[model samples]
Target: MEAVVFDGNKLKLSYEKNYPKPEILDDDDVIVEVHYAGICGTDLHIIHGEFPAIKTKPIALGHESSGVIHAVGKNSVYKVGQKVAIDPNKACNLCDFCHKGNYQYCLTAGINSTIGIWKDGGWAQYVRVPQQQIFALPDEITTEQAGLCEPYSCVSHGFNRASPLKVGERILVLGAGIIGNLWITTLHHHGHREVTVSEMNLTRLDIVKRLETGYRLVTPDVLAKENTTYDVIIDCTGVGKVMEISFNYLREGGKYVLFGCCPPAHTTSLNPFQIYNKELTIIGVKINPFSFPSAISWLKAMGSRYVDYHKLGVKTYALSEYADAMEDLKKGSVAKAVFKVVKD
Candidate 1:
């Protein structure tokens, strides 16, 4: 099986034609024949050696993917030929957090138990995944759209983290990348029409304009001048300075959802007085714990009507064309990039 592997020791990513294919070790595991896999921002981090991939040896690098089950496990309910999407975040059911029903804080998180990040993931022809991480797609969602389910679920988790958020509340999403676009569309679907999104990429801004929702797209340079304050502000840029400045956009009692992955060592100055005066709430969101089922349903209902992949600037490339895909993404030519592991 061909795979895009990241050699952490060498700090390089390569296309290996004869990479070892995965096999089911656990009776509850199933081998998915990958169809399409999205290249997430974390994949870029792994490529650049920014993400801590030394958790294990070199591994296939991709997590947001959808596929058909090629091999089924004895204990799994799903059979071969079933279409599904992977959640990637495998929680240790024995942890205290798991016992408390908070799977996101599972003890395995620190140990890089996450698929693609530490273990072999969906970038290859097939990946062995626990049945718990797989969600069978409905008849309405194409396998291509299922490839998007993982990222959409992550965004859903972030949105769900901002509890008590009303439908008509003012919302702002920073960054027009994959995560940012997902946040905007999720808000739009929930009747949050008058939403604002900040992005520097003109191409992405143009794509954001096609959205049937609000048209408050603006570049970073002119963001502060908009004089806009939002009831809920979501930071998807993951840039330290962007996250730092987003604090100013929240209304007096607004909530700030820190959904982006900022660099570990990045620091920002805090204004304790301003926070005290505003009574603003700041919360952080992690991986998609229990969001895949809802996300797949949302995608089914919103397909083409509200969540148009082409309008979102998503394009698929052959796994062998990873360089071209990565180039387009880095150049802001596409909002989301996915590898077409198998032909349509």
Candidate 2:
């Protein structure tokens, strides 16, 4: 099997031709023949040794993917040939957090429980997944849409963390990457319009402009010059400086949703008095817990009926084009990049 492997001892990613095929270890395990695998910003962070909580190396690098069942366990209810989306994060049902219905915080999920990050994942032609983490895809959605299940779920979780969100709030998304674009799309789906999206990259800004979502797009320099305040500010940049400076963008009683993955060792200084006076609420989301179902629903409604996700700049490349995918992502030329592993 061919795969993109993370060098165990070094901060390097390599495309290998003869990677070992994954075998089912448990009676209920299922092997999915990957079709579409998304290259996420977190993958770049992991490659640069910035992302924390990585438990293992030499692991396959895709956590967001969609495919079909190549093989199923004897005890599994799911059958082969079924299309599905991968939820790489798995939680132990017997844990304390699981008991409280907060499985995202499951203690056992901290290490080898999650697939793409800690164990082998979908960066290969085949990936072994626990039966519980497999989500069946509906016929109404395409495989490309399903490949974004993980990040869509994460954005859904983050948006909800900033509770009391209104339909006409002055929302500011600080970044125009896939996550930021997804945030805008999700907000627009929920009846929010006139969002102000700030970015330094002109190409990214142009992509958003072409989408014609009625958003107000501007460069960082223009934003700094205007000094306009927003009712809710969402930081999708994850840069230390951006996180620190965004405090000035939020209005009184506004919510600050931290949706991006910043460096684990990165820290910044903020004005405590401003937080106190403005009565701002800062919320941080870890991973999608119970939001996988929501992602499916959104994919069906938003992807199928309301919005065309591909128009948001999600593009698919051949598995052999891993270098081009990374380069495109680094240049902010694509909203989301996916590796097409299978012909589907």
Report the number of the highest-TM-score candidate.
Answer: 1
RMSD of each: 1.5, 1.7
**Could you tell me the lDDT of residue 252 within candidate 1?**
92
**Residue by residue across 33-112, what tens digits does model 2's lDDT show?**
99989888888887888875354548888888899999988888799999999898866778788878777777777323
As a whole number from 0 to 100, the lDDT of residue 173 in candidate 2 is 92
Model 2 stretches with alpha carbons more than 4 Å out: 53-57, 110-112, 304-309
Q: Quote the positional error of residue 209 for candidate 1 in Å.
A: 1.9
Residue 12 CA displacement from its true place in model 1, Å: 0.6
lDDT of 1 by residue, 1-344 (tens): 99988888888778899999888789999999999999988778767766667545888988888999999778999999999998888668787887776788876662257788878888889999999889998888888888889888888787778977797788888899878888888887777777888898988999887775765888887877868788988899877788678789888998989888876666777688888999988889878888888899899988886567787879988878888988998898999898889865
Report the CA-based lDDT of candidate 1 relative to the real structure.
Answer: 0.84
lDDT of 1 at 259: 87
TM-score of each: 0.96, 0.95
